[model samples]
Target: MLKFVLKRLLHMIPLLLGVSLLTFLLMSLAPGDYFTTLLQNPQISPDTVARLKAQFHLDQPWYVQYFYWFKSVLHGDFGYSMAYKIPATSLIFARLWNTFLLSFVAMIMAWAVAVPLGIWAAVKKDSWIDRACSLIAFVGLSVPDVLLSLLALWFAAATRWFPVGGAQSPYYDLLTPMQQFWDRVHYLILPALVLAASSLAGIMRQMRSNLLDTLRAEYVTAARARGLGEGWVIWKHALRNAINPLLTIFGYSLASLLSGAFIVENIMAWPGLGRLTMEAFFAKDSYLVVDSVVMATALLVMGNFIADLLLAWSDPRIRLK
Candidate 1:
């Protein structure tokens, strides 16, 4: 297990490098940069702009800049954020938690609802309950995240039930710890739901299919012949095998939630890494963009790695591989 983990970690290095290189190349193709807006200032001279570019290696060729940036990255420096005027790492870490919190809540919400609903639907296959779940899943799969976010905003606006945006109330600091927790959760409901909704349908459908297939397996029949209670046979035997595939999906879903958060965060004004990344991208903060992309790529790699570990642990056959 340790050897497998170390191998996966080693593989992540090249994957991250490739992602960073591609992001850097694409970012370079965009016109202008963080300094462009500064150039328009009447008080700032061309020499000042020149000095700024030189200081940040913006005047250098893309490869040269990437080399210097990569060197710093090797030493645990993520470079500076031109827009935020801070270390890129610090800026990213500051927003990282918010994104993680939102993604975590959304993941829990999705799986908590999806798994049970899927299992129940499969158990009652072809019944009204199954059909209803299918209809709901279809709607969830069909609706885009952007539209869902807009609808969530509208609902928040019209009903006044949930806070429309941000992660807490304005007076959050004054609240008691318990109140503060609930305050954050109150604000969390909308964006988290929006983020979870997009993935929930797919997971539910996958779970339903996997469970259905597992239930029909010869092993399930054998378990039944052994006189295992119906519930035990279904929940313990069938679910154990059925859920293995979803563990792989579970890993990808983390990265998916982060990517989806980019849009949901912006639309809902939720302060998170995604919103920060978007801001940096528009400002053409090259270092910040590279850093954000690297961070996201790391999350993706880690998610898959963790998933692989879970897959192996859950099924001994995989560990042998």
Candidate 2:
């Protein structure tokens, strides 16, 4: 396991470098930049623009600028964010925690609801309950997150049951600790639900399929013939094998938890990396864009790595292979 992990970590170095280079090249290909936007303002003279470009090394060749940026990145300096007028690292870190919190909880909620529901649907296949689960899953899979977020906002507005947008109420700081916690949860519910809906639907469907296949295996029949309780056969034996595919899904979910939050976060006014990255993109903030992409790519690699570890742990055959 240690050897496998080390090998994966070694592989990520060049992978990250390739991602950063490709991301930088793509950003460079985009015509105009942060300074180009500033050029439109009649008050900002050409000399000022030239000086600013030079200061940021934007005046340098693309490769030269990339080298400097990469060097700085290695030293933990993510460069400056001209749009936000903050250090890129600072800006990203400030929002990182919030994005992490939102993504983690939403994914957990998704898997939590999906697993058992999936098992139940599989076990009671073709029944009314299965049909109901299928109907709900179809709705979840069909609805676009943006539309769902908008609808959630509308519901919050009409019913006043939840905060309409944002991560917390205005008086969050003044509230008692417990009140603050619930206030955060209240604000979190709509956006989290919006984010998790599609994921939950997909996971549930996958779980149902996997579990159904496992239940049909000869092992399950053998267990039944051995006088094992149906519950024991299903829960202890079938469930363990059925869940392997879901574990893989869980790993992929770790990566998407943030990237997938973009649309929902923007619509719901959640302060997270998704909204920040969008803002940076429109503003042509090179450092911010590159940093965000690199961060996301790192997450993707890490997610796969963790997934591999889980697979090896759960199935001894994996390690032997």
Candidate 3:
């Protein structure tokens, strides 16, 4: 298993290199250079531009620039953000953490709701409960995330059940530790629900289908014949087998949450990597763009790798190979 993990980690080297290289090239080829925005103002003179260019190594050949950037990357430097006037590493990591926090909460909420509901739907297949679940799931799958988030934002305004936007309440600074916790939760509700809703529905639908299928399997029949309680047969025998697939999809859902938190982050006014990426896009901060892409890709790759290991552990049929 250790060897398998090591091998997989080693294999990611080339994939990451390809990802970085492609992002670098594509970002470099973008229509505007990082300095274009700075130069747009007539107040900035040519000598200043020349000095800025020289300082950023913009005057150098692209190869030389890439070489320097690559060297810095090896030293854990993500380069400076020309727009922000700050080191990329300093700002990016904090925002990345915010993104992670939001996405992680969303994933937890999604699985929490999805697994039980899916199991119930499967257990009660062909009944009213199952039919109702299917209808909700279909609507969830059909609703656009942006539209859903917008509706949720409006609902928050009307219901006052949650903050319409932002990561924490204004009173957070004055709160006690326990109060702070509750405040953050209060602030997170609408955004987390908005983020989790569609994901939960999808997972529930998939799990329900898989569980229903598993219930019909020969193994399940054999378990039932052994005089096992219905609950034990379903939860232990059927669910264990059925949930393997959900385990795999859960990893994908995890990756999706981490990578696709943009809409939710924006809707919540969350200070996160997605917001930074949007800013970078507008500024054409090529290095920042490439760095953000690399970070997101790395997170996804790591998520999948962990998921694979988890799947292998959960089902002995899937070994390290």
Candidate 4:
């Protein structure tokens, strides 16, 4: 198991390098500068523009600038954001937690709901409940997250029950500690639902299909013939094998879920790394852009690692390999 983990970790290094290098190159090659918008003000003189450009090392050759970028990155200096007038690392860290919180919650909720529903659907086969769940899953898969968010916002408006968007209401800061917790969670409802909807669809459908296949396998039928309790036969034996296929994709889902967080954050004004990345990109704050990408990549790698560990724990075959 340790060897397998180590091997996977080894493989991740080059993947991260490729991601960073490609991101850096893409950002560099893009046609724009931090100064482009700033210099548009007729009141700002060329001297000021030149000074600003030089201060941020925009005057340096691309290669030289990137070399220094690599150096600073190694030393943990993620550089400054001209747009926000703050260090890139600090800004990113602030948003990172929010993004992480939302993504993790949404993914957990989706899996929790999906796995059971999937198992039930599989056990029932083409029955009405299965057909209805399939239809719901189909609609969820088809619907755009943006539209879902908008619809959720409308629902909140109509009901006046949940805060429409943002991480918290204006009264959040004024609330007592316990109320604050609940308020924030309330704010999370819409965004979390939006983020998890499609994921729930996919997970449910995948697990249902997987469980059905496992239930049909010879081992499962043999277990039933041996007078194994129905619950134990299905939940213990069939589920264990059925879940293996789901586990493989779960790692990829973690990374994709974070990527999806970007869009959801922007729509809901959740104040997360996704929104920060967008702001940095528009401002041509390459320092922030590069650092944020690297940080996101690191997070994604960590998520994948956790999934690998979970997979190993659940499957003895994986441990041996």
Candidate 1 per-residue lDDT, tens place, 1-321, comes to 678778888989889889999998999988887898988899999999999999999998888999999999889899999888989888888788898898889999999999999999999999999999999999999999999999999999999999888888999999999999999889998899999999899999999999999999999999999999999999999999999999999888887888899999999999998998899898899999888888878877787888888888898788622
How would you encode candidate 3's per-residue C-alpha lDDT over 269-308 as one tens digit per residue? 7778888888887787767877887787777888888889
Name the weakest run of 10 consecutive residues (lDDT summed) in model 2. Answer: 312-321
What is the Cα-based TM-score of model 1?
0.95
Judge candidate 2 at residue 270 and give its lDDT: 92
Candidate 3, residue 279: how far the Cα is off, in Å: 1.1
In model 4, how large is the Cα lDDT of residue 290?
Answer: 79
Q: Candidates ranked by lDDT, best first?
A: 1, 2, 4, 3
Task: Indicate whether candidate 1 or candidate 4 has the larger lDDT.
Answer: 1
Please provide, for model 2 over 108-201, each residue's C-alpha lDDT reduced to its tens digit, 9 standing for 90 to 100: 8998999989999999999998999999899998998878889989999999998877888898899999999999899888888878886888
The local distance difference test score of model 2 is: 0.87
Q: lDDT at 217 for candidate 1?
A: 96
Which has the higher lDDT value, candidate number 2 or candidate number 3?
2
To one decimal, what is the Cα RMSD in angstroms of model 2 from the true structure?
1.7
TM-score against truth, every candidate: 0.95, 0.95, 0.94, 0.93
